[model samples]
Target: MKKTFQYVDYLWDEAKAAELGDDQVALFLYRSNILGADLRITNYGGGNTSCKTIEKDPLTNEEVEVMWVKGSGGDIGTLTRKGIAGLYTERLRNLKNVYGGLEDEDRMVGLFNHCIYDLDSKAPSIDTPLHGLLPFKHIDHLHPDALIAVAAAKDSEQVTKEIWGDTMGWVPWQRPGFDLGLQLEKCLNENPGIRGIVLGSHGLFTWGDTSYECYVNSLEVIEMASEYIEKKIKENGEVFGGQKIEALPAEERKEKAAELMPLLRGLASSENQMIGHFTDSDTVLQYINSNDLERLAPMGTSCPDHFLRTKIQPLILTLDPSDEVIDTEATLKKLEPSFEQYREEYLQYYENHKHANSPAMRDPNPVIIIYPGVGMFSFAKNKQTTRVASEFYVNAINVMRGAEAISEYTSLPRQEAFDIEYWLLEEAKLQRMPAEKPLSRKVAIVTGAAGGIGKAIADKLVAEGANVVLTDISQENLEEALATYKRDEAAIALCDVTKEESIEKAYKEANLAFGGVDIVVHSAGLAISKSLPDTTLKDWELLQNVLVKGQFLMAQKGVEIMRKQGLGGDIVNIASKNGLVSGPNNVGYGTAKAAQQHMTRLLAAELGGDHIRVNTVNPDGVIVGSKIWEGDWAEGRAKAHGIKVEDLPAHYAKRNLLNEIILPEDIANGVFACVGILEKSTGNTINVDGGMANAFVR
Candidate 1:
């Protein structure tokens, strides 16, 4: 029987992190899941996960020692303490620096001798030796699609040099057990104080002092690789159109999908799920039926990391697999010789290129194969594996198809691939490390940043080390926002959000000033109280333009810039608490604000594939440094309620369970949380409104 896997829904928003008992754990899981799905870093059971904690043990009655890594075979999506096998630091370190040469099997057995497995079901993760080599408190490792795409290429070494430069140390892939650990030891020693490591033909390794830090760094580094590959693919690809596979009837498609699953399962092992991604995307469909697919079949993957799922080559689909044209019987006939030929070629290549210590030989069944007009297949041991394989294949197919229009889609030669495949030192180094903030290389653009929530979010992002572009409709307010921060880390942009032309001009100026924009903060909004009956068309329009249209335009233009640069950015919309929960008699204002939250989700859904994260922050009647605090609005509300504005602050503060007043910093903190200042969050509206809506924000 064939089994199918579907995408899992996990929280990846900043505000949502507050709900988790341990934010760092939540962050790690979110990042690990993304990387797992990405196809560059991890495929099936290829990577490992770990986190460090300073906890008091009941038996010892003191703080306990060491980190806990996810036990082997546990999915990254729902990892828990039981899934983590605790490994003492001293034991792991001792295993890494062992000087004597030993057989690969001996080393593997020796490494496992240290692990004291608690549960009968739990086995220590395969990358235990690699984990012991990193110095960070928390770490994550994955064979990300983009990183693998580059690493698995024939000219991977040269490609890595051109793409990553000296920032990340690249190690050639070695067999995944003990020897790889030794290789990482040498690379880490050479690149003192390096943040992360990229394993050629393998995946990526990143770390930070905290889980959030490590997770964000993983996102950042892989994103860099993804961006590089996307550009190269775009520049070099030709638009070889594909056929419409989705047009097949549901029953027929399902049966076809079922038939293909066993072949994929045979290659991936029965433990894995062979996910089917029959896309409506023109590019994918077109590539499935392209006339050039046969010629390009031997071209292999866009990158090598996909090998875990895709293998080095895929079965090309130049004809339909329907009963009329091609049946399973005929499919088997075609695949038998092809499989034999592939095995012979692979074995000969390995025999000729073998080094002293190399990875154990596996089967030569194609991990990926084309199915004519129907689509493609990626064989993996499980759902995570299948998902990653699907992603990699789609990206590669897209790149290859696109590049076909412009140039020949050639990969690096077999010798280079063999070098990465057999490189001892490189495999040893692919361990998890702590994540860092995502804003290190980013330039953020913030509007309506004249010292309220905008200033607060900007300041927090800067503290986490992002270069901020703080903008406001008011020049004085913009100056005020600038005055509160270091001049170099932050800049000021002046523009009214209501005018599309002004919005365009401001973005252009910000880009010119900062070189590019990787994140956006829309804090510019209008606040006026009037019953729906009393509201004028002008008032409604003004509110709509500033609060709603402002964000839309910013996102639309911001996405364009981010997409072109290959740096998928984040957008934080400053909506109001009224948007989500019930509030006063202002109709236009509430509607506009509510619309902002939905817009955030829309953008996130639309641009997620492009690597952009979009979210909203709703503050409840905040009193952060603004004219509203001192002006008629505050006094009028105070008088209407028969209380002084001074007293209103205390009254509101005491309303929440925390009994804390929502400051500009609080709202700002919400914004920073969205910009990957913290590792987990998106498509959420954080309430900085003194716990106004118990039903909504926590």
Candidate 2:
């Protein structure tokens, strides 16, 4: 509720705005950033801003008034001019006349398209009409947590009058569309002196002649609501104190989350369709552990805006409060009946509310799941949607807490929620999303992902729309690699593949992250170059453990999870060309890799019945960006070849028929091609050695 606006920053933004040819667009971006930077004001992609401005048309060569509203697909925090859609006001106003007799969203969308001022501008937000109908020059609409707390209260109108006095107007719940926009306009006209309006069971709206004035109006209103909620909490302290809530210790929570997340994910998934889970944050725990969770959690979302993201009601797991440890087997047994009951209730709710022309019902699977001893698990078709739903639900819990502290929380009636959920405008948002990539909805795990070829493979998988869990012995390196991706789908697990417990934990993390593993890249290995006579027993054993034993454990763990889910999977092992053809002074490393190559074929034979494919990539002399080929190992290999360390790469490349140096990415490309693109060819070795005549698999 604290105001974040600074006069100096505002002045600086204004000074920079004059330099951009489109001042209105620049100012809109600036104000939107200020609003988005504060989560208490608005969450990711949850709010919008607009400005009415004059621009010269390219064809007409005359100035026309336009409403530049936030576009549909981008976040406001980093909004650019391209993120705002430009619509000709004169043409947009004409929609009111035609739209009165229309209820079809597709036709309304066509009408909206016809009013665009610029053909290349992005699609305007669905709420564009609400902004266009208002007469103000600047407008801001947001779903602030504090304001939502007030809006969802049972006596919201009374609270609005008390906190906002005559400056605010209240409108009852109406699905966002042509009619709703008209209703908002009517409210403003009737209350000529009101500074803003509260959309009951929805959000807040404020406007002024300038962007700063509108921004200030939003802050002041939200602060007022916060103060009211705080006062209520103080007065009703005794009433709130009666609720019994207990939190598990941090270590216990972590242990329980690992066991429960995978079971929840597997239960939520079906053939060719999977849902992932994330339990890293404390927000979910704080809400799920509350004693009042059962009474308040079943109440619908804080606003209709969240219906498309989070379904009407979250699925609550039945767990005994006193049980300190989660028995995964027993929990799954109990969940079977509860899941069936939840599905029945969900379908009945849909049948009770469906109209003749309603769109097809979405899957009945739960979007949010509450785990008693651990935390909450959010499930979605992919990683990004899962994260977004998690964020919204967390904010909803905060709003619920505030509302309950003052009065009982209330959302729109169930029928109204159904209407919003089926509204064509809302449904279009999902239908218009870009087509999925080839590996979309797939999950991959890459061992030795801290650097070199393993890191490159992880990057390639993510680019193809696969959620990846990068595992390595070095936690620091894993974190640094994870930071570069900037995606919620990419996670890191510090794992030593030689240890059974470590390998199991990594796969569990992957399951929790992306439901189940479909692709496994066994790229963790160590290179120890030494002559057969000089290699001691300890050195040879170390190489064998890391390369041969480590790969076996990693592959076994991945296959077990895949088999449980009953989904066909892919496993690609990274082996060296020396495994096929012996090279001087490469005894320990070469022998271990040879064992790994044979093991790949054996595993392939065993798992083929389950439709699981196993393959290997033999990459030779891949020196560039390879951490394994650094320091003493590189110098020793070069010395054995009678060449300087700097000249070793050229020496190896010149010996190959293609006469090209192999890089880490070349190996990564081979791995991806073997497991991802080649789908039919398994138990085969793909040689990525720049045409090594002797190392060929024949």
In terms of lDDT, the best-performing candidate is 2
What are the per-residue Cα lDDT tens digits for candidate 1 across 1-698?
11121222222455655566575545556556654554334554557777666556555677655666767656564565556676665656765455355455344534664644233324575577677666677787775656665655556667666766766777886646667766777888998777777776566678888666776667667666666756765764534543334345545544454444333333333222222223324455567666676667676654444443466667653345564412445655555565567667777878887776776655555566666645555544322344456666776664454334323455546665665545443344232323434565466888877766677777778877677778787888777668877535677878888778787667655544444567888887767666677778998998898888899999987776665445457888988777876555568778988899899888888888887888888876577474435564676456645688888778767776678887888887787777765445667777777666453754
Go through the candidates in order and give the C-alpha RMSD of each one to the true structure: 18.7, 3.3
- When summed lDDT is taken over every stretch of 10 residues in candidate 1, the lowest stretch is 1-10
Model 1 residue 684 CA deviation in Å: 59
Structural similarity to truth (TM-score) of each candidate: 0.46, 0.91
- The C-alpha lDDT values of all candidates are 0.63, 0.80
Show model 2 residue runs off by greater than 4 Å: 1-22, 101-106, 238-245, 279-283, 321-330, 501-516, 563-568, 609-611, 639-644
What total of clashing residue pairs does each candidate reach? 57, 0
| Candidate that scores best on TM-score | 2
Q: In model 2, how large is the Cα lDDT of residue 309?
A: 79
